[model samples]
Target: MHELIVSPFLGNHLVVRPGSPKGLKVPKHRYLELQQAAEADGAIPGWLHKPVLRQWGLDLRGQNARPALLVRDTVSHEYGRASYEVNMACNWECPHCYLGLKEDTGMEWSDRELLLYLLRDAGVLWLQLTGGEPTIDRQFPAVYSLAYELGMMIEVLTNGSRLHNPLLLSLLTERRPYRLTLSLYGATEESYDRLTQRRGAWKAFRRGVDAALEAGLPVELSVIVTRDNEHEIDAMYDLARSLDVRTREYNNMTPTYFGSGETLSAQALTRGGQRGVFTGCDAGHTSLHVDPLGMASICKVARDKQLPLLTEGLDGLSKLGGIADQALLRQGGCSGCQLSEQCSTCMPLAQRYRQANAPLGSYCQHTPKEVTTA
Candidate 1:
């Protein structure tokens, strides 16, 4: 079971990031008072009944079942929710793919088990598994099984191509994931093939989703917005809703497709321009992305500048400062830009401004004149 901590944060209600527990503030002495109350009658304050709070392990019955704090002299470290990019091996090669293609060098199962053990030890109650196509991994089932057994609510991110595989479907049926987030590239068969550049992929995606839903597994769809299928977004939305579950729209393929030196399709460029400010990135501080080789970074975009988690373990936390530690852009395109109040420029897209080959302006075509200078 996951455990939560009550600690002080930015002068308001508690803050709960992905991998960390919810931190609720109380008068210092009131902390013990609540714990005692929990012990006496499991009386969790009504304020603790936020849905997200309950998801992070707060007992609504007012019972505080968090593990007793260890009497350690060392200053504590925060390790909350985790995301593991099990492999870069995907079955599809959509033109907009940033990493180019998947690599075959897989992580060892022993190390995989070890990573799970470490995460569970750190009180990780949620684990997200994504990949080029995580199901393509031969050992995916084993790794996912271990995570499930560890009591972590598991989320599998897939391109929806191979969910129809018998073995993978069997495993999913057996373990039953918290949710299967299907990355939908298009609304129609032709559009899916055009966007994903895979023959019969749309058929496979449908079969997979149907299999999961038929097996009584919860499924959600997130349409991957790209020039190839941008026009079909509404159709995709209608399709998603027809499935009778949650649905969402993802990336316009602009800032997200940075670093690969690829420009957006003229379509994606025009339908969307940069916003006045954009700061939704929640990498290093809240989320951790670990590649198959054990390189852990704040997010997939910043993987090149990552730390090897196998060697550093918890001690590596100090070295994992994300966007804040990054140097100023060459022209300082993102520096002192209050447009960040309205600017969509984040570290990954900001880093591209320094790349001679990068279509920096294309990513942020809407930057106002005054805020353009660092």
Candidate 2:
């Protein structure tokens, strides 16, 4: 017999069955039995059973037998990787932006010092530089250079608003195998401007994209679903294809704690309630968010001070035990969702719902309700 423990975090149940070198084989009937037992004992929510079963390879009809938990502690350890968000200053004011606030003035040396301490101490080998716009940070090159010196694989998420700076472009060109994730607000100027709420932003973003391409940087484009531009998804996809870029990644516009949720909701409702309930989130366990203040949060959208698992130093992080044990227990709205597979339940989206005191209006024309249905 294997001892299986189910812990909830960010609305998903992490099933840990200890002492099983081989993953445990769980049949549908047995899972249901566990669910009923837990529910009767007030230990688990009924809503969770479906998603957990689905995640463990149990079919909807509950007919599948012997769904095993294929466990490899070594594999699990390797899956545990360290990631950090370097900064939170961006150049654009897109309505769906989620960095909390804009501060183009750049980070002080003290801020950089804290970042360096955290990165070094955490043993972070993979890093992500995100911001209101990371390239807009005057110290971005310094930050990038330090990460490179530390031999960390770096990924940058930007709006492409400031990619044309010659020095910045040169730095990126000199860095080999770096990834640039660009946010495409719209496929055309009319839609783009409306989404970003800034005139000439469209042109600037285009130039930035071209510059990144010319610099030979590996680039990936992300698009946020909003009411004003749902129809343009295919158009953006076509544009990415034309640029010899990969497919446009789609994210549901989530509101953050800092005054951006209202704008995101307005855009979502205007787009005919395309955004809906977020059912699944993988923060705290597989992914983590580090704020500009050096606080480690389970999700970027939910910047709860109480959930700061790690402060701004590697020493603090190491003292917290293994990264796997730091997984956050799920709470609030995410606790009741059933569509763990199809829904985009992230911190930013959760923050929007928290701000609105209601569910996010739909902005995803491409996501059918059935896809997220329980």
Candidate 3:
């Protein structure tokens, strides 16, 4: 459990805490000084004494002040954030899951370590650990600890199934992820169990949520609105209130990553709303994503192409910006569309909708001038 993490973030020298977003920038020389100090049991640098004490409440001047610090190596190239799918195995069978086939396998220990180190070297500071259910992965703790040690602030996206497990709970409590996002299927047992197709799922979820909040973990609830559970949406919000945690709602469903429309069947027809204007995104330019097998993509949705991280290593990321650029272009089905300028869906996402043969109303604007004659 290090008190401070000193690393290079997006070409800037930064000092960040383990479970917090607040960061302070320091000069390169000072960053190098702290890196050297971390290697030896030397005095805290005079320039850092006040800011460190004021921010973290650690008195570097105290005789007993032996602040545990971790200094990460600088990277020549990098992104600011990334999401890694730790595993595809889940304890529940929610039909709305966009993963399609869920496999219970991941990289070997050595390759897993390499992936984290690569992420570190690529300058990924905010790392998200997601999965079919990341908590259930046998190697989750090791993967999470390695990412933390590599000076990345971690966020975990889980189905809330294994959060109550003693070993897993203890590990999370001690390490303290910046946030633990749990997906809420329904407010009560009947709808929840039916929706997830897992008996006693509501009970397990309640236990996990309670234990996490009681343990002072930063927990957020994601209310997944679907046809089966939309009736209980109000109750779901009430449940989040009762638990005194922040909550977000997901009203629309996307097709499977493989372009299958099966998962979209769960969307609540009434709640299927328009996405905000797709001005643009910083996907590969400022952020990236990686799957369980070390396949790096621009993001989760536009994953038709990927970079094999295990094979190409960090240097391979140089091509990611080009991939991202191509994904945003109005090509294929969207090419020559009249309303493309103001369209909310990007080209890659529109491609998924078209692949599924989804109704135009599901994603495209319904105006008369929406599309041009071919």
lDDT of 1: 0.64
Q: What lDDT tens digits, residue by residue, belong to model 3 across residues 1-374?
A: 67788888777889887766577899999999988887776776777878988787766674321357778887777688999999999999999998988999799999999999888888888999999898888899999988987778899999887888999889888887888999999989999999999999999999999889888888999999999999998999999999998998898888888788998889996686668878999998879999999999999988988999999987889889999999899887678776777788877878888889988877786565557745
Sort all candidates by lDDT, best to worst: 3, 1, 2
- Model 1 worst lDDT run, 10 consecutive residues: 66-75
Q: Alpha-carbon error at 323 in model 1, in Å?
A: 7.3
lDDT of each: 0.64, 0.55, 0.86
Clash count of each predicted structure? 14, 23, 1
Better of 2 and 3 by lDDT: 3
**Residue 74, model 3: Cα distance from true site in angstroms:** 1.6
Q: TM-score, each model? A: 0.74, 0.63, 0.93
Best by TM-score: 3
* Candidate maximizing lDDT: 3
- lDDT measured at residue 63 in model 3 versus the true structure, 0 to 100: 30
Q: By the lDDT metric, which is better: model 1 or model 2? A: 1
Query: Model 1, which residues run further than 4 Å from truth?
Result: 1-76, 254-258, 266-270, 274-276, 280-282, 322-324, 327-331, 336-340, 353-356, 365-368, 372-374
Write the candidate numbers in order of decreasing TM-score. 3, 1, 2
- Candidate 2 per-residue C-alpha lDDT over 36-112 given as tens digits, one digit per residue, 9 for 90 to 100: 54444433334434765654443324322122221111111111234455555554666666554665444466666
